[model samples]
Target chain A: MSQRSAGPELLRLIELMARLPGFGPRSARRAVLFLLKRKDQMLLPLADALRDAGEKIDRCEICGNFDTVQPCAVCQADGRDDGVICVVEDVPDLWALERGGSFRGRYHVLGGVLSAIDGIGPDDLHIGPLVGRVEAGGIREVILALNATVDGQTTAHYVADMLEGTGVEVTRLAHGVPVGGELDHLDDGTLAAALRSRRDVKR
Target chain B: MSQRSAGPELLRLIELMARLPGFGPRSARRAVLFLLKRKDQMLLPLADALRDAGEKIDRCEICGNFDTVQPCAVCQADGRDDGVICVVEDVPDLWALERGGSFRGRYHVLGGVLSAIDGIGPDDLHIGPLVGRVEAGGIREVILALNATVDGQTTAHYVADMLEGTGVEVTRLAHGVPVGGELDHLDDGTLAAALRSRRDVKR
Candidate 1:
């Protein structure tokens, strides 16, 4: 493995680097070497950043989004519609929705969806907190922006059932052909969904 | 770009991570998020490892390899043949050779090969120090274990020419079809080299 060639400390760095999402063993080695080469410019700054993030970044108390602040920027921001709440699978989904710049409401991050195979149930996700938010009143609408997967749908239905008597209007992202998608390349399931939920033309 | 969603520290971390060899903008974001998610297990350890490596790891005085020690592990190791020196293009090449565990000689890292197009010459490399090591007398043979590229060979020849009258026997890695390689998928140059350097089978 050439693990012994580079000292133990450097090898440890490579091992930890390999654990990162996009890096495998080979790429991790390359990354560690690159970091070593640019110690002043990259290595030191990254180390400092990681330490700072570990200390500063935390889950938002209100929305479950990650931020340095307790309530998170989205929850604390002014001029946003406090009446609507977008429920997403995780922080990344919240970030994706924010990147679109369309949704003006705050978000409630449901840590993950209900997965039967993975042993994840209602309690495993942030569904309890979500229901609590809706039950406390003031929220008029809740958008279930979960992924269009089997687990996601099951979780969405489960959440909807939980909020039945709460007087909140539940909605979900539309299932159809994606914007800029070619119908010929789409699966039969998506085509069928698009046909069933066909919207009327405004013109 | 949703860059503002994450705080300034995290955004800065992502920016620096994008400069790493294997990570691009998208993957850098994924990596940063992954680190943030696993703060105690992965993030803290990685940050500590980087800081340790940055503080300890430096170029070996004798061999030019990156190491926590002055002469590096390979240069300081006992039982290796001190009389034969293996010259390579970079630290990764040295690590690759070490992983193979075949060569028992020490190495001299050239840092880079001669590239006229890139303005890299002998002086830019550790060629003078290598010659000095050979001239000081114990080295009997020098193996040019560089890559089989045009620049690698040109650098090899340049190094050999510089050591002309030093009584050091200069050698290079033999060109052939790679071990366990199929003939059909082999390149023309490799097939030709394998055929021309055909060796007699021992009875």
Candidate 2:
């Protein structure tokens, strides 16, 4: 025997599965076996869902969010505050904000941050369309909801510079200790920021 | 807005993905986003592989292993010691043994071990077919390469009881410290078993 564990079809499935995020060879093998064990319930549905999403899903031309429509559901939805747009680094970040149900504004996905080491420039993101959206007017404020990394801050600074003369207020998420966060567990920078931005008690 | 983060198509995909073995809601969301970002390269190929596997893969009638063919590659392969059959708890265990390239004998996958808590019994497994193969009168030895868990050992005992009068020898995997295993980290049962099964060193 040639030491081949499974047939080509099963092997191919395992190979592709290992490439997925958060999976390696061993976990992928375990997952494939799990799928095979419940072929009708999980394997077929996941396969169909993948194909359907691939064929039907399209990026929103306006905000770069993915949906089954030309302008994504968020972009097409009514009553969303169109005057205030929140700029996120990626779709997941947009989803994260939306899940909180606090942000009632629109969103613009930048696709990625401006990473110097990765050779990603401002032009590589949706900065042009974002500027166009602001220049087209009626927008009062732009919320930069990017990550707290160095790349994210640099990208936010660059975006703020780009919209300096647009007459629209460009703001960012506040830097402070998170809700339910322990000061002892927080980093020195976060603690310092929290202390610096301390507020007075109304009572 | 209805608090919907994404469209129904993308939502369904995420729902199905969250059902995988190692993925939860957060990791599934991350993975789906990663897939959508590489729709043409990763998502499409994964979907294609899944559909192909679902349509093409078959369970081996003789040994209960999955492959593209009926009897599977392991069953049909020559030069294997047909007289000795290595019994495994599932197809993954068979694959693990095959990857080692040390087992020259054929395999018999039991689908799963007997689990009383889960209401799993001999009838739920491939034990009947295994006994039939042994009774067909060419098999000389049966190696119970099962896990060392309580359910596994109980099932092994039950199988040995069923094959009591078959005139065929029944064996089990050795209990000992594993390769690169540390003595300090070894469990009491394993240390005792290893000491009990010690053999004299050959000159």
Candidate 3:
């Protein structure tokens, strides 16, 4: 953390690396040293990657997902169901859902939920654009795959209300014990919701 | 982890980011998204920093410490004790010792310790340059401020032996329980060394 110990450029590299989501000063220094040690193999390639990403990547105009393409590969893909749209809070959630591979529909990224404390309103998100996509039309359903947090729920409810008269059926991800999750570790609210929404088993 | 979900450039960025010391696949994706979000502020600066460090930084010819200068800032500093050289296993250790602010001497970076399993020998390190420095004269002492690991101790012994007939006094960092460390949490070897090398209190 003492800047004078290492050179200014090296110190600056560590400082910027520390700004990464999970990196602290110590881990940043370690990462910088790691990069320094593997200059040709790792450092140069990483730098090139960063620069290339910076220059090439942009938010998808249709879904708000970041990609090199304007509409994004997801949006550009012809195999997905255009009749259904899955609304998510951020790109990570979109990626997670895609990884699950169950949903065949396209996605609409909200960028973030409506947080009054942080002064985020509907305008701050991609809500208007979502409504426009639904209004313009072939979408039969819009699934709100937002987090179950207060801000997320509020945003979902607001979006559902806005799209009420648009003829599209607004739905949400189910509230239940996650698959492979233990009942003992489940919270009371989730357990109660799961019990209330229990499905009948078919032979 | 799904390469096709995010575009090629973004995927490549995440792949390179995953190679960083502490980042895994998930965290690398998060870090990449974080950079994407703060394109002008964080991403560009980090890219610039990496490129600058890659282009400008080089190992000091005399000490092997990485810096923008050929001799490095430490080797060029006029106030430090030129008569003493603190030998370390790597640049991180050199930085750590410098951060302590107790060592007024210059340093010699060994790059790495001799590891039989890794096939690292004496030639792989900067031991030859160190001996050359001592042989050139004016150096009164050489402190082996290496780690307490087996390889570190082995390297220290090897270095001591190499500098045996050169008329330079050789020493090592003291082996003891670290300051502010609890005795109960200390290892038996450290405790034994501390006990055997106990210093008398003035009071």
Candidate 4:
């Protein structure tokens, strides 16, 4: 292979980029070269930003979102409708809903849905804390924005069952999402349509 | 628009990722969350790798290729045949040829071709240095591995004309490549075919 002309620092950057989802060695090289060409405009700023973020940020204590503070701005917001908490399987889903600008509430991330075959159980999820939040607070609605996976539905049903006598309104994001599709993959129109058509889940 | 549930660090990562070539906020958030969840396995290592790379590498002083050293390993290597120098417009082209496991000689990167419309003249390139190298050494062949663009052809001819009396063989890559196609986009097989079918340019 033609050796990289850059020093250890650039080589490290290319290696890290290669580990990203779709970047291969060729693309990684191109990307690194491009960044180097625009070092003043892109590379140095990106480096400083990443380093600063890495050194300063932490996970939100209340809902598991990213934030500079302990509970995150969303969880700590005074005006947010805390009575309605949206529960999602991943951070992307929460971002999607927030982008719609329709929901003005807080969030609860399960990290991932329960997958028995994958050895992911209830304890592995944030389900316990969700139940605790519902029981301890003045929660009126718990919007389940989980994916339309078999596992997602299973976890949703499990949560709904657990909170049955707690007299809380439990609903799921509507159908129309393709099977095994991720919330992040859906277009804004499709996501909005799904949200608009949401149906309640009865235990 | 979706509020980050994790922390500012995660949000910052997602924001930074969204600015990358093909990623959007949604995908960025998903990627950041995935990296975070797999921090020990992916995120932390990636972050460390980025930091290390940003701190170590530099451009090769001789050929403008990314390198850790000034002259770089390519320029310092005595094993590379000095008789035939393959001249390319960029380092990526050199790397592409190298990936095919062919070509055993050293290289001269012109950085870019002569584009009068873009105000890129011979003086703006490393052509003068290349000529000096050819004149000062026992160089026999100068293979022009520049793109097949009109500008590339013009630059190649100019270089050939400048080195005429030096008794050095000046050759251009074959026209097997279609017009307007970038060498970077061509496959190894196509590139190999082109190289094997290289034609001599009549002055």
Candidate 5:
């Protein structure tokens, strides 16, 4: 990239592709070459898809989930409980919970966590919108399905503090061993949490 | 991806992106989310770049390198030695050699090596054109700068055989320890090669 030899157009494509989460300069070059090889099959469709997605996908007005609609498909869908809300830190977290295909309650995406180092406070996130959603009435519970990182926990605690005295129970995701997780593979913190939060077998 | 919840257009974008090398479903989803967050800045420009690169970039007619021009920049560049050709296995290899900024001679991209398992043969590559180039005259040395692999060596032999009696000298890259390579970290084969091809130190 420092010594550019390829066409400017191709190099530009590599530069942008390298901005993705896992791609580096070397991998981006390989990906570009691969895409160029399958111009009609892969490159054209991908270009069209990227543009179309960018044009259509917008955040849901209610939950901040990305969709082609204002309120999102999750918010618009019937039978999902509006009384209970599962709060997440980012869009990827919301999508991750959706992948489980079990959560039937509505969702509230906070956009990001509270990071003092990053100068991200409550105002930087959608915490105020969340509190407003809670204050709108009829919400019974707010499950803080946030990550177990320091920033994530701080954000969850702050959201919980803001949502108090509203006659609604605020909760955080339980610390325990994952369903198929091995004790050997788990870290000391997870193991300790698992041991501390042990539940009795109800046979 | 199996339990799709994101917008159809966004999901389509992820699906196409996942097909790219080094991208899996999870990373693709994360990338799509990242792109959606910066619609105007990253996503749109990437989409435009993809389309533009695909439309404009083409393989060099003479060297098989990807570029906007038919003969490519390297092939058309003035003052490059036409008497010496560095034969490479693919575009990336050609690019790698060019990155050194030392190979002043012209290049001949073979497109690929002769692989029996992959059903790749000499006819599948640009060997015919290479032979034609040598037979047409003006070329002196044909450096086999192919990778140090079985298929590469086999292809080098085949090319060398083909170039015989064409009045052009066929050479290969030296097999030895790389410059600045530590002997302890080097493989046995490379160490053996380095020892076998050792040169007297100039006083």
Candidate 6:
């Protein structure tokens, strides 16, 4: 048997877990110990989860979000207005919007924006599919809820330019909040500024 | 479908998670949202773990610790000294001792101790097997590392009485920490006091 199989599996799990955010080696050890104590309640289930996800995770074909189901529930929901798609850089922002319970629209996940330094371009994201979704017809508004970063604005403008002749309304989320500031972290002032000052696409 | 399967599974998971120590409902909701956003990295594994552990958890037959295995690793380790057993009230205490890396002996998990007001008795704990283990052979000393609570002392005395004719050296952890004070929370002075005042079993 390998040295990996020699000692307790829980110890190895703790070592891996120690690398996670907010968990130092001491905290990881404590968490592992807690899981061991409540093995029935925590440890075994956690192990099963790790195994299951390792076997089954896949990205949604339409939005590039991780899900077991194809297209994912959000893409398939009947109540969501497909004609008014909210475009975001990642799925976390989509979920943040969903928690607010205000918007009842479909979403287009860009995966990430155009970053010249990172070598990311329009082809790297789901931009082609987003344009197709818009041009397919009946679509009115495309909300650019991307972050306020330069990359995010650049990506927004690039998408707007692509969709210009298609007669769809394109708008970008307002700036003033710091780049990479998640919607969840925004106070009402910043959230309101981002919401109320949302501007029409210039390109 | 059952009502259990009808509502949002993620919501239910968050509700259950909110009750955990150090987390409130808001944090639990945020955690669930975070998991959902990173479904591939966090959610699917967590879900599988919850299901698997829910199915396989059981208390250990010998030491009453929770584990999927019959005899837990600590209980089954042949390298541990059976001659010097450290007794503790809960698995958390056992875990603390394990982290300290000083003790080379095996442990006896009491599960709890004698509390007249709460109706806990010697029979309620694993005291019988403890005495049997001490008296059988090769065992030289029994460490009474129970809490400093009134009931803890009461249970310690009761166990000492049961081992009077056994001739095994029975000793208690010294008393300096107050009742309800956990070893995890104690300073060096208090922990050392508890260590130094350890007395011979007064049967």
By lDDT, the best candidate is 3
In model 5 chain B, the worst 10-residue window by lDDT is B1-10
**Per-residue lDDT of model 3, residues A50-103, tens digit only:** 999999999999999888887888998888999999999999999999888888
Question: What is the DockQ for all candidates, taken in turn?
Answer: 0.72, 0.65, 0.67, 0.39, 0.70, 0.11
DockQ of 2: 0.65
Error of 6 at A191 (Å): 10
Alpha-carbon deviation at A47 in model 2, angstroms: 0.7
lDDT per residue as tens, model 6, A126-149: 999989888889899999998877
The residue-by-residue lDDT of candidate 5 on A1-203, one tens digit each, is 32335878887898998898899988988999899989999999999999899888899988898899888888888888989999999988888888888888999999999999999988888988888988999899999999999999999899899998887899999998899888899999999998998888883
Off by over 4 Å in 3: A1-4, B1-4
Off by more than 4 A, model 4: A2-11, A116-119, A176-203, B2-16, B22-26, B38-41, B114-124, B149-154, B174-203
- Comparing candidate 2 with candidate 6, which one achieves the higher TM-score? 2
Candidate 6 similarity to native, TM-score:
0.61
lDDT (C-alpha) at residue B76 in model 3? 85
Task: Give one digit per residue, the lDDT tens place, for model 1 in B1-203.
Answer: 46446788777888988999878888888888888888889989998999999999999999989999888989888999999999999888899999999998999999999999999987899999999999999999999999999999999999999999999999999999888999999999999999999999883
Score candidate 3 by TM-score against the native: 0.93
Q: Least lDDT summed over 10 consecutive residues: which range in candidate 5 chain A?
A: A1-10
lDDT of 2 by residue, B1-203 (tens): 13366777788889988888899988898898889988999999999999999988878999988888888888989899999999999988898888888898988999899998999988999999999999998999999999999999999999899888999999999999999999899999999999999989893
lDDT tens per residue, model 3, B155-188: 9999999999999999999999898999999999
lDDT by residue (tens digit), candidate 1, A61-85 = 8899889987888898888999999
TM-score of chain B of each: 0.97, 0.97, 0.96, 0.70, 0.95, 0.70
lDDT of 6 at A114: 99
Binned by DockQ into CAPRI classes (incorrect, acceptable, medium, high), candidate 5 is: medium
Tens digits of per-residue lDDT for model 4 on A64-103? 7666777777788787898999999876777677777788
RMSD of 2: 1.8
Give interface RMSD for all predictions: 1.4, 2.1, 1.4, 3.2, 1.8, 7.3
Query: Given the true complex, what DockQ would model 4 score?
Result: 0.39
lDDT of 5 by residue, B23-127 (tens): 988889889889999999899999999989988998888878899887888888888899999999988888888888888898998988999999998889999
RMSD of each: 1.8, 1.8, 2.1, 6.7, 1.7, 8.2
Off by over 4 Å in 5: A1-4, B1-4
Off by over 4 Å in 1: A2-4
